[model samples]
Target: MPYIASFDIGTTNAKGVLVTHEAKSILEKSVPITTIQTEHTAEQNPDQWLDAVLKITKEWLSVGIRAKDIAAITFSGQMQDCIPVTAEGEPVRPAILYSDARAGKQAERIKDELGTALIREKTGNHMDGTLTFPKIIWLQEQEPVTYEQTASFLISAKDYVIGKLTGRLVTDPTSAATTGVMNLEKRTWQTDWLERYGIAADKMPEICPADEVVGQVTEQAAKKTGFAPGTPVLCGIGDAGAATIGAGVSQQGEMYAYIGTTGWIAIPTKEVTYAGEGVFHLTHPEPGMHIAIAPLMNAGNAYKWAMSVFGTNTKMSDKFAFQEMEEQMQASDRRTSNLLFLPYLNGERCPVQNPDATACFIGIKATTKREEMCIAVLEGVAMGMKQVMELISDASDYKRITLIGGGSKSKVWNQIIADMLGLEVLVPEESQYLPSMGAAALGFINLGWDSDYQAFSQRLTAAQTFERYIPDPAMSEHYEHKYRRYIKLYPALEPLFETSLDSE
Candidate 1:
């Protein structure tokens, strides 16, 4: 069986997964990448990504997965980061990551220069620091030499790797949409948008469908990474977009919630869409589909923080750690009862859209125990999801949801999401490999192994029997009372969080 290699170039790490056309896993490995930080910027060396990719690919090849059997290679990547390359395809500067908010000033300037209505209508995304356009503008002003020397900008980790492999430059529509440089109507790069930001039109890659064949692996890349020299390289999608398809979120109203380092609520849609005010609607990796989205910075990270801060001794044993914590919660009758948590540890996106937002624990009692507070931390993250769902439910009534990522593994967290959101949650059978499976599915479709996506998806994905937990009537009521109050705490403390920052 021909195997498809999927590279997921994530923030903080790069992962390579090898899977057969039947969606069977062959081998997988990961390598870490650094996130360089300043007071206001989070950047990663594009070369670090290249190094990690090579490390991971070599590790996979060491396990006996040969070069020739690898029929196609594709990628899923951290969304919205811009990777600028020279005409000769060398990275000009470190990538501006998705979480970096240094472009706030540029974002405001762009909105003022081109009005929000026109921006949204054209880009199908909100005017935010997270998009590539503002970041590109920031680069132009701050690093004029680098900006002038660049050839084309690619919008994902995988795109950078693809460029390395084939020496060809292009980006898929989903990735391009996040750049705020794609024409939502024409389904191509918007030269007008690029020009508005003073970006040369030649600096953009050819916008293509996710499954479009871009080029073949060059001799250098094939030898360095062990992929065959002539293997077809497919233009892949953003990680979330690929994962959504991997989890079988196709057609209208099918929703998926992915919680890894960050958390997101995505609803696949048919007709070109917009999130109005509080959300972003970006093109999906699958051609002709779009997704309504709300992403939160600190869901899994919040849990990781709690484990590190309070349960450090048992951090590696997440299930055991959480099991003991939940036992404490039940013993105390949900004692974190009135306490509420704002899960903005690294600021917030999606519904709130505030980068300066800070996490806070409110209603702490004198008797609040460490474990009880830990449970509140968990509940607080769920509350954040509830807040997003409330906004989404106001626009669309979604009946069922699919869950993915690290959070999906925890039954306690899964139940919390279900109870808090008041919805049925479905986890895919290949729960851990959704993005890889999605990437492989793309290759399968392109390789003519599957006739239609629907048929392939049905065979490729199965719903894991989710341990459903309906909202506890009283607990739900308590959350309603707490969430109303929780909503006020942020605004009330907003000035204080900002004021404290100036003192530094």
Candidate 2:
């Protein structure tokens, strides 16, 4: 039987998964991508991503899986990147990651020129500095030499690898949407917007459907990646789009939450109306559907920080540190803790758009224990989720939630989320790699193995049982009181963030 190999190129690393027809993940590998970071900027070398794919593919072959057995390859990766490449697909410079907000001035200038209402009407998103188009403008204005020599500015990490594999500089609408240039209604590049910015149309990548076969792997890519020459490659969607479909959440009112290194509450909808600022409307891989997203820059990573700083010691192994922390948190007898944490370690995206926001613990006293502080970290992220859920759903009868990603593995955190939101949380067996599996849907379709994304998603997720966390009715008043307090802290703290940054 043939297999589909998918690569999820994320912020800090590249994760590769080999999936079977039954949606079973047989082999998995991860490699770190070197990041060059400074104040208000984040960048990566695209060659490291290509090297990771090569390493993972060869490692898979070493384990007795033949190169020919791999039927097709696809990708679901980090969106809204700015990677400038030459004519031969070589990187003109480092890639500007989605997290970087150095283009704040450019974003405001774009908004001033085009007007936010017009941009929102065309793109279904707010003009934010963290997006690709603004970063491209930053490049053109700040580094004219680099911008002038660049042939194309790639926006998705996977698109760079695809160009190496198939020599086609193409991207899907879901990925293109993050560029702040794609016309969401037409599902194509809005050349008018690009032309207005004096960005040449030729620099844009070809827009393609997610499920369509773009081209076959070239002989050069074949030699490096250990794949059969002419192996088919697919135009895959963004990680959020993949995760939404991979979790089998295409139907209206089927909402989901992802709490990994980052977090978000997403609802698959048919509406284009802005629920609120920072609520991203991403086009689903399946046509005619849009995934309304309320994004968060913090989640499990905040818990990770707490674990490292407060939980771990030099003598403890990483595994033991995690075990110890879980034990400690579970050991705490307080049903409703008095402490709180603001999980803005890397700043925030929704509810408030401030990048200067910093994390801090509130209600700290002489009596406050480290264990109580750690528990507050989990509760803080849950509180953030609760706020995003209410905003994104917009009282549209959202019943249950499917929670996925690394954070879903937390028993304490999941219960906290369920209690805070009063919704049953379902954590799938394919929690972390769900997006990788979602990329396989297109590969299966290209091979004539599946009819459509919905059918493929159904087949992939139907047999899996989820870990359910039901909300406890008794804790309603307790959490309601806490959430009210939690929401107020951010606003009270927001004014200070600006002053602190200005001083810095």
Q: Pick the candidate with the highest TM-score.
A: 2
Instruction: Quote the lDDT for 155 in model 2.
Output: 78
Candidate 2 lDDT, 112-225, residue by residue in tens:
999999999999999889999999889999999999999998878899999999998888888888888889888988898888889998998888989888989999988877
Instruction: Summarize candidate 1's per-residue lDDT along 389-503 as a digit string, tens digits.
Output: 6655452377668888766776667766666676777876546567766777778779888775666667676433344455566666666677788778777987876766459
Q: Which candidate is the best by lDDT?
A: 2
Instruction: Tell me how far candidate 1 lies from the true structure as C-alpha RMSD in angstroms.
Output: 2.5
The lowest-lDDT stretch of 10 consecutive residues in candidate 2 is 391-400
